[model samples]
Target: MATSSNFFIHTFLISSLTFFPLSPSLADDDTDKPVVEQLVDTLSTIAGPHPGIRKNHAKGIVVLGEFTPSAEASSVSSAEHLQSASTPVTIRFSNTTGIPDIADTNPSSFPKGIAIRFQLADNSYTDIVSISVNRFPVATPEDFLGLLNAVAASGPDTPAPKPITQFLASHPAAKTFVEIEKPAPVSFATQPFYGVNAFKFINKEGEVNYGRYQIIPVNGPEYLTDEQRAAAGNNYLFEELPKRLKQNKAEFILALQLAEKGDEVNDPTMVWPETRQLVKLGTLTIESIDPNGEQFAKQTMFNPLALTDGIEASKDPILLARPSAYAISYGRRLSGQ
Candidate 1:
């Protein structure tokens, strides 16, 4: 029997063939375009061009922290970075979409992002990047571009059966991703974050496991009520985080959701079943706001692919394409474009 998800994908493919058929030459032309450039172009269409700013998740705050691996973490990895020791960290929390001044209460800012750079014991560094949502809208880079294109086509003068509606009618996962209501969080520290991409983790005994990373907030998950959302300031998250840090340290547990033998390791769109086991890897504690927040935000480039010996990225096309897309954004920022 076909799963609902499988049926959806099959139906979507058939609908796409009928409504948006492409010639062989057109398909080849699309394949020839760089993923990074396509990503930037898609973002520009959605949010308008903002030179020198990130293509998405532009509004953010930078902070300083430390990561202390759990006692059990060392058993899983001989990597010096995983040893139970205090490692300095640079952390940034941001809202989704490319609008730099978007209000925190806006629905477009539903899936917030967290990026952390850990300065390892060996004087090297690694980065972990995650978002509040666990599942992605599309499986592949091409599908993601198509979703963006659909959004771009639905302008003020768009006729009935909007491009996004047509796209959603075919793509069930993307439809679900858009339809899901992600309420506003009370503060960045109160929301749980998930590393949507799968990664291979190697243990000291050379045992390798595929899993996605999760960051569970020590403060517990909290959200703003509709009334609270209406009353909040445009930069509530930005204001709340620093004020909360001053009152008490913010913390989160780092965990891994291990995949079963048959899990889809390369498709971020397919979330692993909840029955999978979870291993607590470490704790991340944000002690204070960075005094030089502006400078730190400007200088830091948080790449998800920056990994140590124990961890390696999976073959997910979206995961593989991130570094290059990030580099394009980073270069524009550095050149003051």
Candidate 2:
């Protein structure tokens, strides 16, 4: 239903995994290839439906100064920032691995990555950044090989018999994050994790530092139920987006959580919880979008690597993988320009 480049972060990486885990055949489920195979097949189908969105798929992963936020939080009050929200923003949302011609109305689809840019006070812009629903780095570039293994190990559609228990089956390093260890259809209820790939900070004085960001859904998190996900609509948000955004506004508040220094490095599999509740940084609202209309289909970019000065990225491994793949796909979409 959506397409973008800043939105591109998930396009390349996620589309690559529309597969089941690899494992010896289960009695009734021994008919599929490695999960990676299915994932690739699924993506090949959704990668080319929207013309403009696809064009945007052809741009830069992230340009250093284009849209980074200040290194530190500003003296600007959160209230002021919220009040300043009058500055309207336009965003492009798209499923990175959706099948071509897929119906946006389906609930089983993967989340469309989000790429957002704001017109700042100085008229400068912020680089596009992707906000994904899945927080676990299991899907990040850092977990590539291991993720492939999970899909390789399990059968498609067969939820690992013992989710928490099976997740523990992979052993520590067998999987990138605890998430992938989770057999099939990780629940949004129990596992709403983020790549926490990269981030930037803003100082009231306008100083900036690169950083990482993640969210822990407010409702203890829940994944789509079995029936709602039948049409490959494994995740219900797929069905919810069109409905909510059409009703005037769609909003998701993501508190900002920064990675403290001296912690793990390039460890995309790590999890940082509410032990440090996210700093209430901002709220994302989608005023309204015509799921199949021109504006949503054309004119929106969403490369997660895109950013503003107050939000620079780091040399984090997963963060680093974005530029090339993101740029190529985004460029192809924007090439005629």
Candidate 3:
């Protein structure tokens, strides 16, 4: 007999199929209803609605730190936030999915989240939101919603080649994303996060460079073995970070993978070639976990579009859709819904 956890996982996989059938109709509606509303509605259906809760990555811890710019960084962008001696930073680490209490060891929890906020000299702040996975499943917001809707459409009673199968068949990138193995990290500090969307970096000379952000752990990446995974607890990732931080600071190198002329900046689903140059922008040293980390994580909203001068969002539709989707999520949480 399957355990409760196994049952939940099985049900979730089937329920996800319900989403695909709804996608085409929603995509064609062209209604004045904000895309964020539709996105949230779709997410709520898949994750199950929970008032005062985030639609995804619901469990997380926030840490306070300072970002020290690299001497070499001065050549990349003239953004004042990056030029400052030291900018205060807030970083949040979280598991995947909106199921708040999902087991950390679950396969559904593979692609974790890392959201950062840099407090600038003028008291303004900018955010960089990333995930453990380098590539996104879909290129546009419409397709992402469609993908979710496809998953939601699947049920235990649905046919073997369900809507999700058909959806993945048409969306090759989505199929690849689903098929990829995203192993659980031993700890949040051991994961390498990637900002899937591309951004424009403007230098002092007004020259522009397009690149994606990459956050690599200074201690290097680490993952659990099968034996280790079998022995870990449900809340191991959340529990391990605080203890680890007490022993030593966690650090990550902030770098950018520059895009060549032919690279597609508009599609986040298409990852850039690995041959691109990587420029070090700064180092993030997380000295300690915030005592009120959980509360802070619950209340704060990290917006990728909340950018400062010299850095701007790309033309990616999915990227453009993020701020509004985040706003909707923030408002719902604040209203205690």
Candidate 4:
């Protein structure tokens, strides 16, 4: 009685971020199209087409807030937002899958998402996009494309060692990425979010250090028991966020995990050790839910590469590919796909 949906849910829960390397021989006919377009297409194949929403993280709720920079923030980055002034921000919490109406309690929605946009002076903005799961699976778009193909080919009737299984066998980092436990959070405010990609942070004196972002909830992460999750409504996470904010502001510590010499800066799969130094960048206080958030969520796009001065993208291929993939999805959304 298994279904493709069931298979996808199981496989996707392993790691919503990406998959293993795909072989050229198995390339789809659409290979002629841009890889970004192919990624968008493959995501639709796996998650179904949902019009007027993002191709990934389609189901989300937007919240408004402000970011207060830490005293040490300027020591690591000269970015204007990291300076003395408080910056207004927009934050969106979402499910990993592209299915807009996916039940919040579903295992497929386990690794929740957070996208934070800081609005700076003169109409400039910077964004940080993260998932509750701390790392990414693949290094390049082609590898992710292959993983997507594997998942698309995997179904309930598929033979032993499904494509995803075989993929995990060949790719150790991806295997580890999928094996990480991801439980549903009691509420969006209760979860921690991580920026998996490394970035170059430049200080006022022009010194540079590679670091990854860790957004930890001030109260720390809290998960639901199976019984509680099952008893929760389909939109429980979203509904709970607004009500939580009304009672009091939700807060998170924004910090960077600095990479030591010889650390892998260009590979997202290579997570730096916990023993690495953590620089407290600032505090993000989410204050209110946007009444028009849903409409804004449909139209706005959050790009990790949409960075400001003092923050630059690493050469990580996955990080580099995100903007193009996001652009394709954004266009499709506007066209009512």
Candidate 5:
């Protein structure tokens, strides 16, 4: 018996709203529909760039956090002991809404976590990253910035497009984002960050397969509320991280979320229902810690493009634009302005 599943939730069906310029030579409209994802070709007129908001975010870096994934099977370590077979690990942790100096105690900020690129032993491909953030970019680069600008912006609809600064002032959520820059109730080391990608796994049998990586905090992921913010004050967030690393072993496991075909391609808004099942890939425990000074922070770059093989990018759009922007930003920092 054949079965049907709509799976097309509004958030996921968002691809329906995106525009992709395919080769116009298609014989007919029916033929023009994409086999992977079906979206309206007319998405351009309905949409304009939604300029994402950026607060010239500046935090110090860890000279120790410096390590890149290699195309070969290597190990993750420092000047001393070498351990686990190292894959390229591009990790980033940030509060979605934050200014330079704010308390790290706000749950709404969703201290964003990242570990984009990692290599497999043979290095045929890379593990996909940001399949969770937004979807269209994987389809085309334009969607990443396009959809972002739309969501974050008030747009050209006004008699005059208000400067983003003005629009953000009107939108309280935007302001709250900056106010709660580092809102971590306890220590950020406790939160569980996701690697929202449906990876393609293949075997020597010429068969194809799929999966994703999961990072579970061994001890944390504490959430802070508004009331907690008034008491904690600004330095509280920065204070908690090192305290956790010092008091507890503060470790997280890297696991995999294997996938079958056609999981919810719609509601790009919800997390792709992971079985939440995890397979142990590696472990990340804060060993030697350092200060968040300008030298360590300013010089670092986190680009999604720099991945090792075995992991593959999915048919999502937002994940597409990161590499270019990240590389440019990385180069700018290295240039030492």
Candidate 6:
């Protein structure tokens, strides 16, 4: 039951190695120690050491919901959640950066995040981690680390052509990402989220297709104007969410945009043509906020590679590194770092 057809008329939208396995349940290995440590260190430097919170996307609120698959979904993937039965889901919407108290109005928070955990039978689950930006700033974990290092080094007296400026100058993709217009949304419920990385969707017939996720608000996007944004409170987005949920449930269309032949399925920095095919997967209906959401979020870790059967990670370097990087953050959060 998709609405906002006119809005659809307007827009459209990684695998692993043993050392860098594509599984989220991976334990800490010696090989990944340095990379994980470096990422956590750099993020801490950028955000100034926030403990007991995520190293990134620390400012988030969790909610409980459900996902009902479309009939066409089973044709695209044999994933259990894509079957006839509806599944429960845990959703977290957050602003970017590790600053837990950062104001929702801050520019750095523009590219918001939405992480979804679909719970299946037998204590298993899968997750979809996406951001508001259509494409990522970098393709590999190394480049992302470089970007973070540059930001951490650039200060008021860092001079013209600062470290971040130099990084962006040599990295055109990152420059494009930074230059993207990020207007404030009226609420997270009104914003669309894009999965920058690609994954392989395989059906029971063994047919395969590489695609990314596009989660659209069924009510369409509505943003605050300049004057309204200027007058908004620091916690405007956070406060608006529960009240909006109180009035009625928020709904989103969960779809996948299939990649055509010759498309770069490995590099997140690359954007697929909007003309790519969009497949209906399901509808995610968020009925209410979980009373224990805050406490639960602190303990729950949402991993993109936490895949179920019928879904596989593509060979995207950034995608391969996400679980390890997130694990370090989760570890620290558990230890109250």
**TM-score versus the correct structure, for each prediction:** 0.87, 0.57, 0.89, 0.92, 0.56, 0.87
Candidate 3 lDDT, 213-281, residue by residue in tens: 999999889999989998999999989998998999999999999999989998987898899999989
Query: Which candidate model has the greater TM-score, 3 or 6?
Result: 3
Candidates in descending lDDT order: 4, 6, 3, 1, 2, 5
lDDT of 2 at 116: 53
Candidate 3 Cα RMSD after full superposition onto the native fold (Å): 4.1
For each candidate, what is the lDDT? 0.76, 0.40, 0.77, 0.82, 0.38, 0.79
TM-score of 6: 0.87
What is the alpha-carbon lDDT for the whole of candidate 5?
0.38
Error of 3 at 213 (Å): 0.4
Say which candidate scores most in lDDT: 4
Which whole-number lDDT from 0 to 100 does residue 135 have in model 6? 86
Error of 3 at 143 (Å): 1.5
**282 Cα displacement, candidate 1 (Å):** 1.0
Q: List the residue pairs that clash in candidate 6.
A: 14-313, 14-314, 15-314, 15-315
Residue-level lDDT of model 2, residues 264-326, one tens digit each, is 535544555446434544554455553444434333434555555445556565556555544
> Candidate 3, which ten residues in sequence have the lowest lDDT sum?
15-24
Ranked by TM-score, the better of candidates 1 and 5 is 1
Candidate 4 deviant stretches above 4 angstroms:
1-15, 18-28
Candidate 4 clashing pairs? none
Give a tens-digit lDDT track for model 1, residues 251-331. 999988999999999998799888899888889999888889778777778888999998888999888888887887677
lDDT of 2 at 150: 40
List candidate 1 stretches off by more than 4 Å.
1-33, 44-49, 155-160
What are the root-mean-square deviations of the candidates from the true structure over C-alphas?
6.7, 10.4, 4.1, 2.9, 12.4, 8.7
The top-ranked prediction according to TM-score is: 4
In order of TM-score, best first, we have 4, 3, 6, 1, 2, 5
lDDT of 4: 0.82
- What TM-score should be assigned to candidate 1? 0.87
